[model samples]
Target: MVASPPARFSVPAVTQPRINEANRKSVGPLSMPPRLLLGPGPSNAHPAVLQALSLRQVGHLDPAFLAMMTEVQELLRYAWQTDNRITIPVSGTGSAAMEATIANVIEPGEVMLVGSMGYFGNRLEDMADRYRADVRTIKKPWGEVFSLEELRSALEEHRPKVMALVHAETSTGACQPLEGVGDLCREYNCLLIADTVTSLGGVPLFVDEWGIDLAYSCSQKGLSCPPGASPFTMSDRAFEKLSQRPGKVPNWYLDMSLVGKYWGAERTYHHTAPINMNYAIREALRLIAEEGLENRWQRHQANAELLWEGLEDLGLVLHVQKQYRLPTLTTVRVPAGVDAKAVTSQLLNDYNIEIGNGLGELGGKVWRIGLMGFNSRPENVILLLAALDRVLAAAGYRK
Candidate 1:
């Protein structure tokens, strides 16, 4: 044995390869055209918000950052018109916040009633199903709003733990009225979740008055901030349901139990927060605060009215009826033989303007124009109308 162990086999040593630099390309400085964002969302961020985004970043746990976090929550409360202490900004886009609300409050096997009027409503059903909820969807055609009676019937029949509705259906330019929905939900002992992504800052949203137990919105849409930090609020009743969950929240990242502690007085560390996005959102909220909600809402309404009149003058019909039409986003039916994409493309390429194409069933059949947040201006309305006239004429479509 000693003789056999005397000589061990030696392995060959290969030389390491050097880095290849020949194929590497150096990226140039950032540059882009100044575009008028008239799309369904992400209308131009306020200049102050853009400036705030460039300010130095800070540690997530820094005291200054924590104070800013509290301010952001306060601003969100103002924007949502709610006094709920659970209001905070989720560190993702609106959909993440939407999922956070749906996943936490509705447990597996619990029924969830979805009022599907447009794309976002159907999306809510999808998100609810992903959480293994017993989903029951009551749908209306696209470009339509759900009546209170319809929602009441669905809630009574399904007896769901949650009733989800879209406050503003961006996909169809319809605003679902929430005047009595909260009362209806209360009568059924169900939580009300309002998707306010397109309504939050640009229009009237009385979270407490409307009795919405949970509501979620995005910065990019109505707050005029980049699409990252999204606003979310949970009523005490909703949080109570979340706290009493038999099992841990299915999503670790969106667990309100853990997230609440960080955003609440506990100030615990959960995840590294998006500091710059928070800064941008904070400044955006400040802008909202300075302008006041009523003024902002009026501004949006005025601009939208102008747009509606202009579109009609151009012989374009609106998808949603006037009574239910959304002030923030407008969906126009593509003229009988017009190409929606071609119209949008021409606006982008020739005019540096951006508008959204229809989603889901309405794709290529309509165009979505947003007059929201900072982009909701009379001048913008006039400009977009003029641009559309030129582009449509070029497309050989007569007014």
Candidate 2:
């Protein structure tokens, strides 16, 4: 019995790794589908951009990384058509860039005027309030754009220190005109902040020419890069205002003064930059440059026209007026009898095609189809139209 007990007590050696050492565990291979990305954003990245992300990992401050950063700045400058030295990629998405611009420009109690024409404008007003600024907004119905006269009136009445406007409202698919708004801001001695998240690379953006003191965008929408990086530019005057902030910027992570030092020639370290995301953005920007800004803009415009023509031919109506429609994002009015959600679901489940539903007030009533960067191709346009036509027809809705 004692011998048997001894034999039973011979325990097996512990072979599993300790819980604290789980970092040594092997990871499974990643698998992703080959579905077409034609949503409001996160359009398929160019092959080159994907390849860039596959490159061997490097330190954030690696000499090669720094060089790439310089090139990125230059490429962003080309995309934004700005000579401002403060142009750089933020460490987060388009929203981060928006927050950075607002945080750096507006201080507590500062008067900020915004156009409440779409979702992004609502976001801007929210951000201004979060920053403790006195927010004033000019309301317009969703899917409508602000006129120059309306903006001028707001500037005159509010006398805000800064005015924020969205160049392309993704929610409503309306492109707000910046024609005289910048000059109006200048006339009123106020800074002009423009949100170009849905406009950059897909449309023409002349920061200096437009008198935009600050502008920001994301790489995924029109640059064809995977999300996670935001390209933002600030003018010399805006930088001057940031330098004079009486108190520290509200968010240390987004403080442009410190971020600029890291991204600037000093190459200082404020945080560990997302190296792979930067590589993705650099390559995306490079592709945009290779395509030529004017050519890329034209491509988007042509694709948009094709989509609109096809959709209208199929008897669908566009939400925004033709004159104010955004090139990258199109808002389609949901037919009276069709369920917007059901149509989108069928398109995804049956056809494997992904599009966007409208946001805010336009939700459930409109469908957003984005013809952006790499997704702005004839083939995609045709496929989307064909799929949409089938789905709507099956649902007893025309077009």
Give per-residue CA lDDT, model 2, range 59-174, as digits (tens).
Answer: 99899999989999999999998999999999999999999999998999999999888889999999999999999999899989888888888888999999999999999999
- Estimate, for each residue in 98-163, the C-alpha lDDT of model 1 and write its tens digit: 999998898989999999988899899999999999999999999888888888788878999999
- The window of 10 residues in a row where model 1 has the poorest summed lDDT is 17-26
Q: After best superposition, candidate 1 residue 204: deviation in angstroms? A: 0.6
RMSD score of candidate 2 (Å): 5.1
Q: Which stretches of candidate 2 lie over 4 Å from their true place?
A: 1-28
| Reference-based TM-score of each model | 0.94, 0.93
Q: How does model 1 score by TM-score?
A: 0.94
Give the Å error, residue 127, model 2. Answer: 0.7
Please name the candidate that would achieve the greatest TM-score relative to the true structure: 1
